[model samples]
Target chain A: MDILLALVVAVLLVVGGLFALLAAIGIVRLPDVYTRMHAASKAGTVGSSLMLVAAGLHSGEFATFARAFAGVVFFILTAPVAAHLVAKAAHQAGYRLSRGAVCDDMRDKAKN
Target chain B: MPSAEEKRQRTGLVLPTGFAGLWLLLFCLWLIFNSSLALPILATGVVAATALAWIFTTRSTVWHYVRLTPRTLYHFLAYTGVFFVELVKANVNMLRYVYSPRIDIRPGIVKIRMRLRSPIGRLALANSIALTPGSLVMDVEDDALYVHWLDVRTTDIDEASEMIAGPFEKHLGRVFG
Candidate 1:
């Protein structure tokens, strides 16, 4: 059982690390600032949340698990708000999409 | 300096009625692990966690939105799991792309017409694309996504659009819509 637990924790950590690595790559490879921000938000929140869960498991104590889970909840709640702020700010600052792109509701909103 | 109900709410005794149960669990674990009287430690942990949750929830109207069903909850977990796997695969692919001796990066912007309506769903789609190895969500205007690819694998815009949107949009819709 202890070995099984260790294996689970290891898998979690590796997966979390992979998510973090992908987020960094996205920051570099993505086309626009807003898109990059999206990568950062989801990957950062979920990646760290996974890491925290693993830490809780490794500790094998109830308090640690509770605190870690609480932290994940906090992160999930905050990340989207931050992403919205970034996207809204970018739009307000006059970033344009590619020409072939179809449908733009924000532009319609601003037209009125 | 307050009525009973007000005081209870202020102390967070009204909601999280299972608060004490979680605290008791923590206390027992502390005693078992560290071999000590963990009442004080358990009290501290409960207070801190509750306060943190309260503070986080209070900052935005988003948190006050209606609760999610269990079906939605499972979808969310499954999506995140799939997302993690994609992230890892992307990272490995990115490394290979960056180190290739003869760089063949045909970078260009591609626009994808999207169908997701929920702000959360739209955001998830954009973020998921951005989280992939070579794609970025540069701009989103309503149902359209303007993406920047570090290396364009195809000149056909529709092909690129479908390639990027395939599983991500489907799963995000399930989770957020």
Candidate 2:
């Protein structure tokens, strides 16, 4: 049981770390802020949340797990709202999409 | 407008009805955060929960609408399942996009309409789409939501709405709408 639990923790930590790494790589590699927001909000949230759950599970206590789960809940609920606000602000501030983007339907609506 | 005394009486009437449940929730949250049942903590938790619940009841009518029926509970669970599945799929897609040798994505903004009536329901829909990979909600105006699609597969409003916010809408509608 101890070994199995350790293995689970190790996997969660590694996977979580990999996701965070990917999110960082994405932030550097992506063409524009919007795409970067996607990386940060989606992968980044999962990364931190998984690590939190792993830390909780390592303790092997229900209260610790519940608190960690609450953290996860808070992360998911807020990440998107933050991302949406940033995206809206960027758009409002006239930070247009990179040249790689093919379409922007909001362009006309945003103007008038 | 009502007089100050009338307003006070009205608020007093509203406070007690919603006070207990909110206080219980807040007290439970306090216990979880403290991770203890010590006497001092319990005493403080009770006081803090009561104070916060009283203030909240006096200031807002939002929590009063939250009905805790079994159907809502069931829908909330269903929404959680949908959310986890989407979260996994989101990361898998992100892994592919982030790890690919040369990035090729047709990113664009598309319009989608929300059917949920309540502001909370619409907010939930927006968050669900934004959390999922390949889509981020940029703005919500009236019944319309503008989403930044990482890969612009379709531009039709109805099609995009069905594809992006479809799964969450049904479950959140039951809970919040």
Candidate 3:
């Protein structure tokens, strides 16, 4: 049981770290604010949640697990809302899509 | 002077029915947070939960969304399963895009109509879309949602709605109804 628990924690931490790295690379590589927000919001939230879960599981105490669980729940609830708000604000502030962009329905609507 | 019926309608709760369930849920949350089973802690949990619930139900409009039917419970469990699977898929999709040397993405915004009538249900649907792979809801106007798609598969509104919001809507409908 001890070995199994350690293995689980190791795997979770490694996976979480990899995702966080990917998100960082994506922020630097992606073309615009909107796309970077994607990297920051989804990947970042999931990666952190995974790490928190791993920490909770590693401790093997109910209090630790409870705190970790609360963190996970809070992340899931708040991350997307924050992303939505940022996206809306950026759009309202008149940010343009990347050059490789193919379509713009909002622009078309505004024209009509 | 409003009639008793009018007052009940405004509050939107069936009273004692949902009250018990809400108390139980809040108490469980308290217990989990405290991580204690002592008699003193349990008594405090009960009191705290009850006081919180009573204050919210009486003073706020949140009572309208405090439903606790068995059907909603089942739907909630199922939604949890679906959400996790989609989250994994999203991460994998993003990983591929971030790793590839040659970036090829057809990013655009698309409008999709939602059928959910309840405020809580609509909010859930929007959040689910935002968290899922390759899609973020930029704005919501009436029944329509403006989504910033990482890859614009189609410009058609109906088709886009079916693609982006379809999976989440069914479970949310049942849960929020």
Using Cα atoms, each model's DockQ against the true complex is 0.12, 0.82, 0.75
What docking class should model 1 receive? Answer: incorrect
**What is the C-alpha local distance difference test score of each model?**
0.64, 0.88, 0.86
True-vs-predicted CA distance for residue B130, candidate 2, Å: 1.3
Count of backbone collisions within predicted model 3: 0
Model 2 C-alpha lDDT per residue in residues B89-139, reported as the tens digit of each score: 999998998899999888999889989887667777888898886899998
> What is chain B's TM-score across the candidates, in the order shown?
0.62, 0.85, 0.84
Q: What would the per-residue lDDT of candidate 3 be over residues B56-75, giving only the tens digit for each residue?
A: 65565544554677888888
Native interface contact recovery, all models: 0.03, 0.84, 0.71
Question: For every model shown, what is its TM-score relative to the native structure?
Answer: 0.51, 0.91, 0.90
Q: Write the per-residue lDDT of candidate 1 for residues A61-86, one digit (tens) a residue.
A: 87678678777766765665566567
- Full candidate order by DockQ, most accurate first: 2, 3, 1
Error of 3 at A39 (Å): 0.8
Give the local distance difference test score of model 1: 0.64
